[model samples]
Target: MIESCSGIYRIKNLSDNKFYIGSAKNLKLRWFDHRKLLRKNAHFNFHLQRAWNLHGESSFEFECIEFCEFEKLIEREQNYLDKYYHLNVLYNLNPTACSQAGMLHNQDTKLKISTALKGRVVTDEHRLALSISWHKSDKCKKQNEEARKKASLSKLGKKESIETRVKKSIAHTGKKQKPHTEETKRKISETKRNKKNVNLIKGDIYAEPS
Candidate 1:
């Protein structure tokens, strides 16, 4: 039986001495929630969840580090976080206490996520759903367009590596590209002409004494 109290808590992994620190109004309820989510592998903290999965429940110990008033819960938790901020043993995904927003994952966590997603497969239904969701949002479409433009600008005058060129060649080997429509051709020609005019104005392209 756990005591119900407002306090700062630590969930420590006995195996590695790594731990996650948090505070709650009711320590007992919070501990219960953590265990429930961890058992189901659905904890909001992915770092803690992964560690719990790697090292069984028996390897973890939960304890109330300090009993504080409800108002001071966050402050107390932040103190513990600051104390261990530089250490690599903390399993906390967020550097700050009280809120999990705006926290960037460490490189180790990023590599772990990359490795976990490396061979994951997305179903056609899932892919279609994602496409539909993106298409449904005007903001997403605008942002995507902006990203494409930025990427196009960044790639200008850049040479691809030999390996990249070979991979692209292989990928497009059997693909047939559709011919541009007359309207598209006209637009392309106009764009090129405008670029040439700009370059001539800037003295980038030499005009032959005309």
Candidate 2:
């Protein structure tokens, strides 16, 4: 598979119990093109598209994938899929195999330019003239830099609110979530009651001695 934006995909055949599993970096573009080819009744048709039409989308699934660096992932996955699914078959021309097998056949014919067209070569004088015309204008540059600095300062000045801080803490705290136990609930209620009592006592103590 072309190591696109790093995604795993599979196309299954409902008619036969066969399946093809592969990965790509750009799953949407790659799959969309595959679907289009199937619509046009193209020869390099994928069985997964057939299964989607025949059995529905629920039939085909790509399982157990983690996004990672492309160079490491594609080679590792290509080998893994080959072993797990026996998908490295040369004769098979489904989506997984067709790209590999038909690559030789799809070689683009190289275009050659016979001769260069004779033209006036720009000298250092011409270069200076163009640079002076465009690069000397400092108004647009200053305006652009000022705008960029204003945006940067605006973003930097945004303080995290209490709600945002709590959310961020919850996300980054490596605590596994669990349902609250009876003991934990009791402790929480006690804490709330203590705080309420403290507030009440403070008001009474601070009141005028009448």
Candidate 3:
């Protein structure tokens, strides 16, 4: 009969006797959230998620550590965190016990968030925050295959300039190369001759290669 009350709570994994300390405005509601997330294998905290997966629901015990005013909740959570900071013993996931209640977003809201940040200039502090967020994200580890293919296709059929061609020729000047086959030579000559004939028929032939 845990009631909706502001307090510090601890989730004890009975399997390994590890503890995770947190505080919430409503003990009952927050406990329900933790149970739901763990059951779904979708908890935001990796350490807590792993524990839940390793040990099933029956192995967890939710206990009210102490009741506190809503304003002093985070402070009380931090005090509990400090007590368990030594020896890496506690399974507490937060580096600091400064957690806000989580929120859920649908796909449309996620898209809106992405659109809003489209052309914003990122400051160093923002970059650091992004680094922290992306440190454990799978998206940062690999490029999407479809995105890579789209990028490749975007550059397709782009013509190189004469300067670029000359620079490339200069770079490969001393490399060994294959001589053109007779068929290739004939095609090249025929192409040039057709261009010359076309220019001549127009009565302005000399400016082109003949």
Candidate 1 Cα errors over 4 Å, as ranges:
99-210
Clashing pairs in 2: 4-25, 5-25, 5-26, 6-25
Candidate 3 runs further than 4 Å off: 101-210
- On residues 1-210, what C-alpha lDDT tens digit does candidate 2 reach at each position? 433466555555444546655555566566665555444433133334344566655554433344555444444445545565444432223212223312232222111111111343555544554454344346657877899999998889588799999999989899778989999999999999999999999999999997
* Weakest ten-residue segment in model 1 by summed lDDT: 96-105
RMSD of each: 15.9, 20.3, 15.1
Of 1 and 3, the candidate ahead on lDDT is 1
What does candidate 1 score on TM?
Answer: 0.48
Give a tens-digit lDDT track for model 3, residues 1-210: 787999999999999888888999999999997887667655656677777878878999999989999877866887888788675768764435654765444566466556755786665544554455454346754556567888899989998899999999999999998999999999999999999989888876346767
Clashing pairs in 1: none
Give per-candidate clash totals.
Answer: 0, 4, 0
lDDT of each: 0.79, 0.52, 0.77
Query: What TM-score, over all chains together, does every model reach?
Result: 0.48, 0.31, 0.48
Per-residue lDDT tens digits for candidate 1, residues 2-60, read: 67988889999999899999988888998987887678666666678778989899999
Off by over 4 Å in 2: 1-4, 13-17, 43-66, 87-210
